[model samples]
Target: MLLANVPITVINRTYSSEHKLISFADTNTLLEICDKFQRPFLHFWTTEQPTLILGINDRHLPNLAAGLKGLAVNHYDYFLRNSGGLAVISDPKVLNVSLFIPTATHNYSIDQAYQIVADLIQTIFPSLTIAVHEIANSYCPGKFDLSVNGQKIAGIAQRRTQRALVLMLYMSIAGDQDGRSDTVAQFYEQGDAYRQDRWHFPKVDKATMTTLANLVSLDISVEAVEDQITTALAAQENAIDLSSAPELLRSAQFINEQATQLKKIQLRNNQLPIV
Candidate 1:
């Protein structure tokens, strides 16, 4: 995990200092803040409840029927994000962040953006215990997964809109990875297994998935992890703002629109029981 260092260039800013440690109760609120910022923001967020988000182009997910039924989950609340990745595991204990960056080039790629954020994360965990490698056989497998040596601790995704790039992330601070993994594994196992083609589904290694609490050994601790983020940000030349309700309301509206469109598709295909 990389820490913030003052860049010598005047055209750039190590803007991580301007980030607000926002505690969002809903994913929609997280989405809205990204849309409302100027100097770009990296929001460390969380959800009110356990939720599953699918990529808009993820049409090959399997076992969706059994996945929804097995959860006793209400699909009305599920949203299909207009971004990349299949499904991500997110919960209250998890620390999720979205970075809204403005790229001048029209051909900005997700890999380029993920590299910038992942590098910062690697700096904080210099032990290199948190491996910055793609955890294959894992849900939403990507190049930017923050793994502990061989195990996965965090995952990152990219969402862009109107030239604004929002880098979405899900960090398992302290929760049941086995439980989260089960949900994802089960979603594919019982939901729509019959629909899977040659494509592989998100894989979760129960043994490998870990939290910050589980990672702290002797010299490094969870408090250290917390301290580092604060200390690292404080050492920088930036300020963080608390998100407001007005931003939340706008987030809810975006969630509604995304979920509504997903509901229609899920109902038509018998993927979700919401309709």
Candidate 2:
């Protein structure tokens, strides 16, 4: 396990449209670092386009064929994530933060992992009235979703290995959050089986979800939000300089080893190949 005072490696990054899979693969790379070297990592990434990332359960959605066709028509590329949670939308306005750390216990509580992120968000936006609870009819419904004034702004998900833990969150920073919500709702509607499927998907209502800009009523750009987050992190903990860290370089090299399987997982889940 990492020493209590070890510096947390912070990576503030954004990716090209084609690097979506590489983005997730990077987190797994950090997970391996935690497992192998007992190091901890923090990552924040922004996507350039509106991408639909579905969860494992999405493969069995009843009208999946229709949904995939609709995704194609809407010009939104899709992929299956290595973590849990239903479908989620990402764009230039959204920020995805993940924490990869070592775990000492065999069974880490899911809520405990989520609370770590929720607490960090509270630290970042101390003035905002943040709430953590499931917002029904919201995309990626979950018990630890973060919201302000009853409208969801972030969703939390977690994945764990025997000795490593990864907690992931997607926060909408700007843009028409309602339109994004509507988009996911439409995907589910197209993919619905007249409620015949054993599993229940969320009934997304745009009003029940919102962006940080909407919540604060400020024209907060995604870049500004990213700056604030990284600044806050730098102030709160020791920041590791990734450029000069040899161990981190090796950790990134590890990602190359896992790339083939990461690419194939989505295809096996019936997702479209990234062109």
Q: Identify the candidate with maximal lDDT.
A: 2
Candidate 2 global TM-score: 0.87
Among all windows of 10 consecutive residues in model 1, the one with the lowest summed lDDT is 8-17
Q: How does candidate 2 score on lDDT? A: 0.76
RMSD of each: 7.9, 3.1
**For each candidate, what TM-score against the reference?**
0.67, 0.87
**lDDT comparing candidate 1 with the true structure:** 0.55
lDDT, candidate 1, at 63: 45
Largest TM-score belongs to which candidate? 2
lDDT of 2 by residue, 131-159 (tens): 99999989989999999989999988888
For model 2, the stretches where C-alpha displacement exceeds 4 angstroms are 1-4, 105-108, 234-237, 240-242, 245-252, 264-275
Candidate 2, which ten residues in sequence have the lowest lDDT sum?
266-275
Give a tens-digit lDDT track for model 1, residues 1-275: 22122121111111121111112222333334334442344455445567666554345655454565665563212444545568775555666665556443333566777875676667676766566778886777778888875778888877666545666667777766678777777766765644665766654556667776567543443334544554444445534333443353356664575466445444533443452
Deviation in Å, model 1, residue 225 alpha carbon: 6.1
Error (Å) of candidate 1 at residue 196 is: 3.2
